[model samples]
Target chain A: MSDTFLPVVAGHAEDGRVAPPSTPRNVPYQNGAPNPSAEALRAQFADAVQRVDVVWGETTVFVDRARVLEIVRWLHDDPTQQYDYLSDVTAVEYRDLDRPIEVVWHLRSLPHRRFLRLKTLLPKGQPLAVPSVWDVYKGADWLERECYDMFGIRFEGHPDLRRLLMWEQYKEGYPLRKDFPLRGRFSRSEQLRQILAQNPEAKYSMEELTVLEAFDELSLEQRNRLRSGEKVGE
Target chain B: MATTTRTIEVELSTTGLDAQGRPQRVPLATDEAGNLVPMTPAPALEPELEGEHMLINIGPQHPATHGVLRLVLELDGETVVRCVPHIGYLHCGFEKIGEYRQYNQIIPWTDREDYLNSPGNNVAFALGAERLFGIEITERCTVLRVIAMELSRLISHCVWLGTFCIDIGAFTPFLWIFQQRERVYTMLESWIGARLTTTLTRVGGMGADIPDGWTEDLANFIRTFPAVLDECNTMLTKNAIWVGRTVGLGAMSADEAINYGLSGPMLRASGVAYDVRKDFPYLDYETYDFDVPVGQTGDVYDRFLVRMEEMRQSIRILDQALKRLPDGPVNVDDHRVILPPKSKATSDMESMIHHFKQVMEGPRPPIGEAYVAVESPKGEKGYYMVSDGTSKPVRWRIRPPSFVNLSAIPKMVEGHLLSDVIAINASIDIVMGEIDR
Candidate 1:
């Protein structure tokens, strides 16, 4: 596919007039030749892997959700293809597309000096999950958490799946999704200030404070009443 | 294993007796059936009394930390059993904001990531956008970018050396290095008009050309910097206190560093010699000649040594780039991509209209994805951009090097002394702006 992606360098389309590389997509402007290792990988994971595509010398291997763990584990364990470094884990949300989110994993085989991008597209919604590669690379611990924190995508076997950049109790929509607005959104500073002010020494443990922070502006009595289903709760 | 037996000086008359007038022997452990059970004998110093585990909080506000970095350290006595870092105090959600802004507008946002390496960040972002747009810049642009990047790396190392020395209780190196750092800012000021947050480069090319006689200032800086480093080495490096504190502290093996996704000096210190500039060349770095320094043992001292050597290499690259600097247009001449020059926009009709359109509606790149990486002073700082054939990008993702490098801190600091955490953290050279972003 990469070899055939010649992108018509200053060449003409079938319509007779010559076309420039800058006007269209995949126009082979600066020579994004196909990677040979991607072809070798396709042969290696013949059945498990669906397809391999190279763009601008980057190899992206498309696989099913169930095979992500197996594919990554084998990649790490294989003698020649030891992608031991899990560099970055991020998701791109496409609300209009069939698969709403693409959970992208960028892996590096440091000893071999190669890069592989593993992407799994999933249906968009809350409580989405994929297999965790934490066991394979320890660096994925926080990066996976950050992915979950931002996109609400769960890595199924992640040991401690907690929000990383955003506070756990700031319950709201995922910031990175297209559906979320860019401005005039929620900010946790006021609530954080009140919580900090009430507890001078921060006597509450992390777990306890997380639970308390859910009632943003409610008083202790009102929160108890709401929990107990008593009168005046509304 | 040989066991030492101590001859007790207890008098026979003082021996407690049971009903049969024999000495009563207390059992160390007992079985469920009331029968005495044998237990493993204790070693000379029975480390069994290691005491209860305690929690140690390092910072979110601690002065020793480089910035607003909080570490929740689970400790057993003075040793760190586990170190969990809590970041994001400086989170401005730069990626989310980038989605709303035009491609060129995001360069300033990238500056906030690794504030110490804004020029490098600008180049990395511009390179990514340029790839998506398929705009190959001039040779002059590439050379200028290389010079700015190397200068940024030098400044970053300067800040790292100063703070790291102060962190390890060496007071003088901090003062000496910042003097060099001040000169770096001044040199950059001559070219870009700002010191820290210059926002100096553009997508298709540089914002502008350097002022006259700027390279001479850079050449002067390069000439006299090594002697200062040598002076610093005299103060530390082999100094008894420096070696004792940093030699074996926070040591990690090569496999462990790779497994934790470590890069730059941290990875090189482990002897992998994996530098993105060499492994994956960008910005005509392949044309340059320099050797990557690798260290055998990944420790605080090795990281320091690797960084010092890297500074020297940066000087070498800078010298070469200055000598071979091309003469041509700095910004790409494509009006669709680049903002028109001020003189042309005011004087010519076509340039006036092109500048108006470009300023109002930003460049519309084709619907595609591009990821460009540069070997930043900290690590591989990459910009992953996904465009949707519009003025703004659909997704703007940053592979922040400092954040990734900071992830290896817990792995480096675990099982080490608490104070060694400071040494290990400094060795990583984390700027919280990058990590939190």
Candidate 2:
């Protein structure tokens, strides 16, 4: 890449709002049919939907977390809506909001060629849970598990929900939370010990466990100590 | 009872054998509530009369698996009854890591996800970032992205064919295809520094302008590549062993494939003409003319045929892009986005400050999210970006096609023989790193 390739990641323009959506979003469509305007979705789920906002040339509806399951089921099952494909499911940590955690879903209708993004915010608490959409779409099986894996956002009725990337018994906090340390909260020594204990046949090395950046800060003796998994700092 | 006829009474447990060779119970995983819970399969109904059924653990490590993938197969006398795929072996927290790094930093990681098509991943990632930034790339950059992407597809498909041929006991094609792959890699290396991990694209444009005469070399390579493909077709496509092993095997209807989230050749082979390139055009793909190959029966043979045709289609795209290569600045000339050139930075006052701020703090985008899907070799390789008005994205989710497509394995493998598992798995064209990411 060149020096010319530095910025633009944050966007060229500072204005967050996109130019108004091409068509009037207030116009409502028939139920079970697509091209559902922000108003149509509101009309469909009058009580549940909080608001609909267009960001970056797409529609993102901030819906009620409590009735998320019912709204999602309707959106998928409604013949007109038929958002059969669950393209992705992810969690975004706002870090500042009361709930702070927002679960986002990208749903697509193959026949209709329409895309919809639905988001629900969760209140701060332990044992985070949401209704599983695995039944509605078999593809949601792993996506939901991953959401739980990274954000500790559980799916209420998921058939098999467990830690995906991390060890099941791992008690380290959810790794994707804004507050979660880039280098994990626990030392590599403890993490390595736990994984090795669980999987004896695994071929992991000390190189994977120790942070090379920290090694630069260490003296030769300390570096050697780290390589040997010895606690030299304390 | 005939059960005494040398048939071992075996029940396959979910866990692996311990040091003592005794089958061990799989450790139950904790739920969100920290309660130990097993992801056990529902009890299989007892047959009217018992028949043989056993479970086999394929790999967290195995040759047939493209990378580190573990598949637990419940088999009934050489027939797969159920397949439960256990991923995450190669999970490096790529999405989580994206939260800490800049947009450019994520492209290299994307390459590693599907190393077989590193440039394809590079362009797909850059496209996602570019859309989020609302910066329309130059004509030259768009053409370059298309060329790189198409070339990567050609290379990735070669790897897929070679590996699949090996799975089916055909070794000659494996050796033969590598020669073409080496030539393609050399061409890629000529312009970009690395061959395999080619992180060769910038957000607004490419890493560097195409090196002198790179296009002509590629055109020369493409001219000879088709004869090799025709040779492969004659050698393997109609061979008795190849036909017997692949034809009418691992077949699924279009609806079932879609419901199971299949895409790319696997989806197209099932008779669904759904191609992201045509359906959801990006990077001026609408201007290009190429046919999307579709197959009637979504069988292993059909998948094989579709991908072969796809290689031809990619060649066509490459030719078109090469013909229409534009002359202009590859990177957008936005001072806010792109940095000032070295020559300008040394001589100017404002340009120097712009460089310092951009190099240190990075750009501050207005908080927003963008989902961009590119027609990658495998399928719809999408990047979902959520920016919280910071240089780093709050949520950078990769919708890997292999991950979604792999979900259809059980549906395709069930009722097929143990040997057909390899054929079906190969047809899916999975890259484990992408799946596990």
Candidate 3:
């Protein structure tokens, strides 16, 4: 939403800097032909925000995290750019880069038939916090929570921020990050067993107890006592 | 069979009761006595006045709910005060799995995303990967892809209409729709090796040529579909009860619909003339002549009408595609990406080696990302894939239309009766496999 990120979509970058070469041969429409209204809106967004980077291949407008909520509010409330819908909220982990994660928000305006992509980059190991867009777009609540649950990026003002896919007692680190092992054998079913074992009051069947203790060295009486609801631990 | 009715007295539980002339337990008090007593509690319960509403969970297993979606519904009697959708019950970590498998290997997995529209999923992923690979498909391959996709669309819509009517208490329509759908599955089975999870499209082109007698059979199927659709529409479309249940129910404004990312029939029914095929033309969609239907009221009835009109339009597109069907190779001549035919691989040594290498070491796509969206039966099905100059994708994400469209349900049924929730959900045509994936 800044002046630096122009209305024109940036092409894919070749050398990883300064933007990619523009393929004008397949340009869907002529650029700078008849764009008085769009140009004015672009200038307005530029005046309101900080730096904007237009990635070439993917048309994204990178805005600072602090001003994202303000930008989204303007985009949704403003009659000229009423981007009322939040299509997606996803994050990418750039392990090779100095700033590791980039959160992307895809917004669409029905009346104008226009699409906008907003992005913010977070430093490595830093907890990225952005204002929740739930008040502006009701559909964004679940998506923002899912983003947090997967990428560990926090949405500070979310009404009910909780792990969506993972269980209530999952203690493992974020599973979708690049640092997580891809093919490692870690069973969530097993994790649930460990949790149940620690809580003596937790009711579980004998068949379930047997399945949980199969991987570990548990005596027959200890397993039976646990299944029969007897407190086995001191 | 005449019978006499008799009343029997039964004893209810008395475990929590105390011996007294009157009943012991009070509504909000711990004990039966008239005197108030403090209850052992943890979290504080917000005070609710008499006749105030509270939240109730409808699923993870309720019959009305689809798959494993759980809805937290706040209600005042039968009217819904607030609604929240809880998902991820069927999540299998597909996006994470994509990072480990090769590009071609992911095609089979996409079939499970929206199992009803497997070919559309295949084409969307193939198109995304093809864009990254910078490969152009052959004319025959494009036509074949359109044919497969359109057939899949018809089948998907049939399944939706069938199940929707069933939800509204009509069972016969489901059988009628399934009869039509079964024919489609049989046709696809003959073309592709598999019926449901048909990995027909490859990155650069189609996997195989059309089987013998396929065109004549397809034409026969198309000729008979319009009559069947008209018959079904006549039976249900004008029914007073059906209209009463659906018309002006679950209404969403055009602005609200778009803001919630509702696409496909939901957006079109909200009076938006936005279809990926028309707006963002992919494959040979630009060449096909079809109408983009729009609804006036953006209600459940409008959504149903849009889908019915869309089925007619799909038939029109199928007729044109059949007429424009080309005679040539289905697979592109990009030996680097396409595998050789099985017959040729056995006879020719050069063909045999190419097949081996193409299967083992998948084609390397340039390091970049591409997002390609297609108009499936439900809505906009977009595949966003990022390649890292390797056979496997670095990231693969699906923008499932059902998942995004289902987000609009709370707004649709905010003040509607509880029973209307089931009808609205049916009209939305959500597939839980796609939503939870």
Considering lDDT, which of the candidate structures 1 and 3 is the better prediction for this target? 1
On a 0 to 100 scale, what is the lDDT of residue B179 in model 3?
A: 92
A1-234: candidate 2 lDDT, tens digit per residue: 011211111111122222211211222211223336456679888988886767656778888887877888887778767776678888888746564588888887766666788888777764567788887777787778778888878788887676666654466878888778887878999878867665322222223223113345544654575577642211
User: Which lDDT tens digits does candidate 3 get at residues B79-130?
Assistant: 8887877677788788888878888889988899899999888888888887
Q: Any runs in candidate 1 off by more than 4 Å, and if so which?
A: A1-32, A95-99, A125-127, A187-234, B1-50, B346-349
> Interface RMSDs of all predictions?
18.6, 18.6, 19.6
Tell me how far the alpha carbon of residue B348 in candidate 3 is from the true structure, in angstroms, after superposition: 8.3
Misplaced by over 4 Å in model 2 are: A1-37, A97-99, A200-234, B1-52
The CAPRI class of candidate 2 is: incorrect
Candidate 3 regions with alpha-carbon error over 4 angstroms: A1-57, A73-85, A95-99, A109-115, A183-189, A192-234, B1-55, B340-357
Per residue, candidate 3 scores C-alpha lDDT tens digits across A81-161 of: 777767778887653556458777877654454556777778885767877888788778677777888777888788767
**lDDT of each residue in B49-120, candidate 2, tens digit only:** 356556677887799987877777777777888776767788787877888788877888988988898999
Return the clash pairs for model 2, or none: A10-B365, A32-A80, A32-A81, A33-A80, B59-B70
lDDT of 3 at B396: 83
Model 1 over residues B1-437: C-alpha lDDT tens digits?
11112121223222243474323333346568875445546767636645767777778899777898888777787898887777777877888999899999999998888999999999989989988887878889989999999999999999999999998899999999999999999988888888999788998899879989988998898899977887886676555457656766677788888888888888877766677776667787767877676666678877887788788789989999999998989988788788776899889999999888888998898877777778999988878888778889988999888788887787788898998999889999999899878
Q: How many collisions per candidate?
A: 0, 5, 12
Task: Tell me the deviation in Å of residue A124 in model 2.
Answer: 1.5
All models, RMSD in angstroms: 14.1, 15.5, 15.0
